[model samples]
Target: MQTASRRFDLSVQYACNKEGLPSRPQFRGWARAALEGGGQVTIRLVEAEEGQELNREYRGKDYATNVLSFPYDTEPRVFGDLVICPDVVAREAAEQGKSLEAHYAHLVVHGMLHLQGWDHEEDDSAEAMEQREREILASLGYPDPYA
Candidate 1:
């Protein structure tokens, strides 16, 4: 079996009104745990407007989502961008009764997995993907998100 790689360049930019979000190191750790490749990824924290625009343009949705991933399918392993909305994250955390940090970690990993071409359009795929996410998050000391 081929062992997963642990090489990635991570960049984080905050464009939202919130302050004191998690650092780049935290996001890098999450990304490394999610994907199996040597690559670089840019994680941007943006407002609802930008997030909504991106979602609408890319996904045909008119609202800002919690996270969005853009993967580069080129050689040299440069993964594309992951845009996260803190506002949505906070709301989801509250609704789900999870810590903000934990939810943030989960979303970051989820987005990274998307960049690696993982999807949950079907039930089986979602289960497998979510199980992988649970394992990875657990290894990072987080509780099972689906539990």
Candidate 2:
């Protein structure tokens, strides 16, 4: 539970260096958009092993997906952490024919929205969240992820 004013703070790490990770400013820009009024967040980039471990331990998924959102507080100066797996992101980007940076931006925005009380558990909620994500991603100059 940390807090900061209208600013995006990110700390990135790598469990491996197979894929080139996004820059700090790139992450800040993406997260800032999702914050609405801006806020502080930590973006941790890991390899597949750590990502899989986190997903398994916390989400009960045996394999790693993409981004994992961990929000701490939101009342005053929204705070949260985003765990991103570079391996999975790169793979997905290649499979989906998207640039690495674009995928990272999408995930960062998606995670930030989740931090601020967004969910995709139900069809309605999922559609709403995806639309929001689409708008944000589009604004960030990325094509629709679902398309």
Candidate 3:
């Protein structure tokens, strides 16, 4: 677990040609807000093809998803990667009536939480994780993503 300092090393990689992706600073801010300890996190934004490939290869899902967390380590210091599909995010944002920035922030926080070992496989766990997301996003001045 991390100490009070909560320092982290963050890298942002854009593999997609999206026109309006979030900036590196924005990614850092969102990831920092969700940090529970020292960590090295990489955020990769990919095109639909790569997104679908990763989802299929890693999660066995054929379609592209909004975000995926790949955590390698969590003890002493955290190390992980967050793969995000901007196209999927944009589509979901339009469908959910959320701003792109807000939706990105929510996913970043959600992925960070997963890197820290949070799970939503069960009803109880899902409720708790969603509540924590609400609190974190609220603190960041974003509306409830679940609403």
Best by TM-score: 3
Backbone collision tally, model 1: 0
Q: Please give the distance, in angstroms, between residue 30's alpha carbon in candidate 2 and its true position after superposition.
A: 0.8
lDDT of 3 by residue, 17-124 (tens): 847899999999999888887899999999999999999999999999999999999987789999999999999999999999999999999999999999999999
Number of clashes recorded per candidate: 0, 0, 1
Evaluation by TM-score, superior candidate among 1 and 2: 1
Give the higher-lDDT candidate: 1 or 3.
3
Per-residue lDDT of model 1, residues 30-146, tens digit only:
888886767778899998899999999999999999999898862456468999999889899999999999999999889887887789999999998999999999999999999
TM-score of model 3 (CA atoms): 0.95
Return the lDDT, model 3, position 111.
97
lDDT for 19 (candidate 3): 72
Q: Which residue pairs show collisions in model 3?
A: 2-37
For lDDT, the strongest prediction is 3
TM-score against truth, every candidate? 0.91, 0.89, 0.95
> Which stretches of model 1 miss by more than 4 angstroms?
1-6, 74-78
User: In model 1, which range of ten residues has the least summed lDDT?
Assistant: 1-10
Cα lDDT computed for each candidate against the true fold = 0.86, 0.83, 0.93
